[model samples]
Target chain A: MIHVQGLRKEFGPNTVLDGINLDVAPGEVVAVVGPSGTGKSTLLRCLNYLEAPTAGTIEIDGLALTAGQETRKQIYAMRQKSTMIFQNFCLFQNKNVLENITLAMEVVQHIPKERAVDQAREILRQIGLLDKQDSYPSTLSGGQQQRVAIGRAMALHTKVMLFDEPTSALDPCLVGEVLSVIQQISQEHNTTMLIVTHEMQFAHDIANRILFLEGGSIVESGAPDEFFYSPKTERAKQFLQYYSMKRYQ
Target chain B: MNFDLSYAIRQFPTILSYTGMTLRIAIVAMVFSVLFSLIITIVRYYRIPVLTPVVNLYIDLFRGTPLLVQLFFIYYGLAQLFPIFVNLSGYAATVIGMTLNTSSYMTEDMRGALESVPRGQVEAGLSVGMTDLQVMRHVILPQAARVAMPVMGNEFISLVKNSSMAFTLGVREIMAEASLLGTSSSNYFECYLDAFIVYFVLSKIITILQNAVERYLNRRGGAVR
Candidate 1:
């Protein structure tokens, strides 16, 4: 389980996240939706300590992730349990897909080459990229590259996977391929996932719960059924109607 | 006096042997310089507080001073100041000079490459539970090396050409040997022309080698651009 409480992050003068709180049950798929520049991505990055929270406490798997020596060590340790997928893919340009997957395993986990290669192969097959194992990240298409990124994360054996606008960089036709891989991971791998996205229908389909964030805070959250239909807040009602209307015409 | 093509040709083998010596010195200097530069770059990359400032001072001093002055300092001034270095040969001084000079330039090349690697990638490495050194070795250096190769290759070619300066310190590399031949034969033009041609061919070879390495690394490494 991941528990976040009183999360406040300020970038110099601008406060991006203001006293935000949330919990994600193990194996849960929670999709966070928000307007542009609403700090939704920042929130997700903070969860992985990619961006340190200015003030907050994040508890992952019963380990406190407060800002201190002991907590910092635990935060690094906790990273083994969680890995983030960036909007930009962030694949190391120097490595092929196999090296990218196996690097952390070899260096951090100290896994041997044969074992790491075996693990990388299994994950590549799972992500439908077995053929691209030796191919450089540059050689693959955007969707295929994203799948390789997912495979790299899976090779880490993290209990929680975080996706930050995973398909934002893809072409319209390529979006579905990447999303399907994410959906498959959610279905088959049993790894907990938290996705921040703008794809409403995809989020609605895969999310166990949905969070709607506005002005640096989550204003509404609930089961997909309730969050999708009969939204209680006027802002939520306005957003859903606007997006749905855009899709219709 | 008419140009003696046969005479120059007759001296070819002697010139080739000295050319071999020049090549050996350049290559050895490049290897040691790259190692030295990597250490300086790692120190700079980590920003090691008081030590980093000192390293920065070291880089600035080496870069600001001329290579000839550095070579002279190593060969003449330092030996005078220190009795232990009294017997240090011209070849050793040339190697030491070239390594230090190339290291200063290579440090900049490497620094540029390190900067070119996106901040997100470093964050990604750290988020995956890698230590700072691991991120540098496994992630940063490989990528940086690809970016640094073309520039470093240029440095290497320059280093070879600059090996001529070793003549001043009495090293018997190509240029020095040519001068010796020039004095003996009383044929300055032919001897020097022979030395020039040797440098031209070596530089051309270095260019071909640099292009091949750059293309190979690009193909093997990540997305070009």
Candidate 2:
């Protein structure tokens, strides 16, 4: 479970998040959808303290941190409760795919090498990249690399997984493979997921609930059926119209 | 200015005798400089409080001056100021001066390579629950070392050539031996030509080694896509 309250982020007097509040239940898939620059990515980053919030409290799986009231150690501990997948697929270039997946498990988690490699192989099998295990990230396509990144995140077994536009960097043909992998993982595992993505259709399909953010605030959030079919806010309606028009055309 | 082939040919055995001294000086200086520069690069990368600026000043001072002057100062000037330095061997002074001079340039080379690693890589490491120190040791340094290899190879090759200057301090290296043999035999051309051949061959060997190392690194993996 994850709880956020009064989350505020500021950059040189430019407020990025304005006292945002949210709650996510276990096994919930919440898709954050909004126009660009609406702080969707920043909000996800704040959950893991990747970008420290100017003011807020984040609680995930019993680990809680309130901005300015937490020590660095507490912050690090809180970060361990969650893992993130980036849009650009930032795999360790120096490591082969198997080594990339096993690195954190062995180094950070202190899992024995044999067990870590076994776990990594299992995750690779799940992602259907077992053959590419020995290949470096540079040799993989953007889609294959992103799957490896997803496999790496899955291996951590964190309470929540935050994804920042995971498919935004992929080619049109490659988007389905990555999204299907994400959908399959969410279905099979009871992990809470908060995904910030522009793929409205994928969100409609995968997310049980959708958050509509505008001007750094959640203007409307509800079950996908209500949020997509009958948005209550004028800003959300206009934004969805623009999104649908741009997405289809 | 007769080119005496026989004398030049005969000078090989004598010049070869001093090759060991030159190799020793260059190897010792290279090892010390690489280790020292690694320290400088790490300190500067972390910006370690007061020490960072001190290291910067050290780099600037050594890099700005000629190595010959630095050697003379360490060997001749410092000995006058401190009695202990009066007994400092010319070999020690040469090694100290070359290490100090070469490490300054190496520090900058390594720092640039370290910085060139993308910010995304560090963030990715942190996102995976690795601490800053772990990220540096596991991810950043390995990539930075790969990036810095060619430049480091060039620095080492230059260091080999630069060690020739140590002759002025009477270290009895190749150049010093060549000059002594040249004056004694009155075959300056032949003796100096032999010295040039030795330097050329040594540099070629270093270049070959550099290429082999580069190939090995590339075989490990390509740069981040």
Candidate 3:
């Protein structure tokens, strides 16, 4: 389980996240849908300590991550339990697909080379990119690179996976392929996932719970069916109307 | 006006001996410089508090100064200040001075490489439970090394050419030997031209070596560009 309460983050004078609260139950897929510059990415990053919160508490799997020396260590430990896939794929330009997957295992987990290679090969196969394992990220298509990024995350075997605008950078046609892979992973693995994305159809289809964010705060969050069919706030209605129009055109 | 092939040919061994001395000093100095520069780079990369600024100032001070002045200071002035230690050999003085000089510039080159690593790569390492040091050591450093090779190779080439300045300290390197020969034979133009040719050839050799290293590292790193 992931829990966040009154989470606040500041960048100098600007408040990127202003007293937000949320929770994700185990094995749940929660999608945070918001317009651009709504601090969606910051909130996701703060969950993993990629960006530290200015105030409030985040507890994951019974480990409390607040602001303190001890909490910092706990936050680090918590990040190991959660894997993040960046929107840009973030594949190392210097490494081939196999090396990219095995790097974290060999260096961080201290897994032996033979064993790590075996595990990496298996993950690559799971992602359906075993043939391209020896190829560099530059040689792969956008969708393929995203699959490699997913493979890298899966290799960590984290309990929670954070997808920060996973398919936002992909071509329109390619987005479906990456989304399908994530949907497949969500079905097969027991890992909890929190995805921040712009694909409204994808959000409606895969998210068991949806949080609509505006101006750095959650306007509404509940089962996707409730939020989609019966939005409570005026802000939620406005957001849905805008998403619908964009989809129509 | 007659070109005497035998005279020039006879002078070849003398030139070759001094060239060897010059090459040895440059190679030794470059090795020392690369080691020290890497140390400074690692310190800066990790943002080690009090020491990082001090190292930065040290690099700036050495890089900003004229090498000729540094050579004189290390060879003559420092020696005068401490007579017992002043007995250090000319070869040692030259190597020490060149190493200090090259390292000041190479430190900057190496720091640029370390910084060029994508933030995503560092973040990925940390996300997987690697400490900051481990990320830098195992992942960042190897990637940086590949990006840093071409620039570092240039520094090495410059170091080799700058090694001629050892002649100013009476080290009897190629340039100094050429000066002596010109004076003795009253063939200043011929002797200096020969010295220039030697330096040019050596510079070309370093360039070739740099290209070879770049190709090898590029292949290993899987750099498409």
Candidate 4:
């Protein structure tokens, strides 16, 4: 489970996230959608403490971090419970696909190398890139690289996996491959996920709920179908209009 | 223009005898330079409190001044300024001077290399729960080391050439021995030519070894299997 309250993030004088409150249940997959520069990615990053919130309380699994009282141990413990995936698919360029997946397991989780390799191999097989396990990420196509990234995230087995534009950086032809992998993983129904994405159709198909954000807060949120088919707020309606028009073209 | 071809050929064996001395200076300095650069770069990379500014000043001090002046300060000047430094040996002063001077340049190279590893890799490492130290070890260093190799090779070659500065401090390395032979035979052209040949060939050998290392790291870290 993930719970956050009054999350505020600032970079210099710019307030990116403003008084955000959120809750995600175990096994729930939430998709956050918004116009550009609306803090969708910042919100996801705040959950994992990738960008420290200027002020907030974040609780994931049993780990907790609150403003003014957070310790390094608490923050890292929270991080171990929740991990973020990036749009860039930043696989360790020095490590092969299998090592990329297995690295955190060995280093952070302190699993033995042999056990981590076995688990990483299982994840690589699941992502349909078992044949390319020894290949470095730079040698793989963008689509294949993202699969390994997801596999890397899976290997950690964190309770909450946050994705920042997982498919936004992918080629149009390769987007489906990654979306399908996410879709398949979402069905396993153990890891809760918060994904910020521009793929409305994929969100509609994969997410249990849709959150439409504007002005640094959730302006409208509902079941994906309801939010897609019947947006309540003007900002959300305009967002859908803009994205859907681009989709049809 | 009064070159002595036969005399120069005879001096080759004498200068080549000191190849080990030149290499000992370069290799020892290279080892110490690498260690100091790693420490200084990591300290600055993380922006550790108090130490970063101190390291920055130290780098500027070594990098801004001449190595010859630095060797003088340690070997000759420091003895006059401080009673404790009176017993410092010439060989020790040369090694210390080279290590300090070389690492400043190397720390700059290492900083660029470390920065070249994309910010995304750091985020990926942290997102997976690796601590900052773990990220530096497993993610940043390997990639940065690859980026740092070529420049580090150049620094090592430069150190080999700069080791000649030790001759003025009464240490009998390549240039010191060459000067002695030149004085004894009055055949300065011949003896100096031998020193030039030795330096050139040693640099070539280092280039070959550096290329081999680059190939191995490139093969292991990048491209197809």
Who wins the lDDT comparison? 2
In model 4, what are the clashing residue pairs, if there are any? none
Q: Single out the weakest 10-residue window by summed lDDT for candidate 3 chain A.
A: A67-76
- Candidate 4 residues B1-225, lDDT tens each? 678889899889989999888889999999999999999999999899999999999999998999999999889998999998888878888999999999998998999999999999999988898899999999999888888889999999999999999898888889999999999999998899899999999999999999999898888858322
Model 1 Cα lDDT, one tens digit per residue, A1-249: 899999989999999999989998999999999788888999888888878888888878777676443465666776766889988888877788898899999988999999999999988888888898888877889898888888888888788899999999999999999999899889887788899998998989999999999989999998888988878898988888888887612
**Better by TM-score, candidate 4 or 3:** 4
The number of the candidate with the highest TM-score is 4
In model 1, the runs with Cα more than 4 Å from the true position are A68-72, B221-223
Inter-residue clash pairs, candidate 1: none
lDDT of 3: 0.85
TM-score of each: 0.94, 0.96, 0.94, 0.97
lDDT of 2 by residue, A1-249 (tens): 999999999999799999999999999999999989989999988998888888989899988889989888887787788999999999998899999999999988999999999999999999999999999999899999999999999999987999999999999999999999999999999989999999999999999899988889999999998988899999888988998788832
Off by over 4 Å in 4: B1-3, B223-225
DockQ of each: 0.61, 0.69, 0.58, 0.66
Q: What local lDDT score does residue B111 receive in model 1, on the 0 to 100 scale?
A: 86
Ranked candidates, highest TM-score first = 4, 2, 1, 3
Cα deviation of B46 in candidate 3 (Å)? 4.1
Cα lDDT tens digits for candidate 2, B1-225? 578999899888889788889989989998999899999889999999999999999999998999999999999999999999999999999999999999999999999998989888998898888888899989998999898889988888888788889889888988998999999989999999999999999999999999998898888787543
True contacts kept of 1: 0.66
Chain B TM-score of every predicted model: 0.94, 0.95, 0.91, 0.95
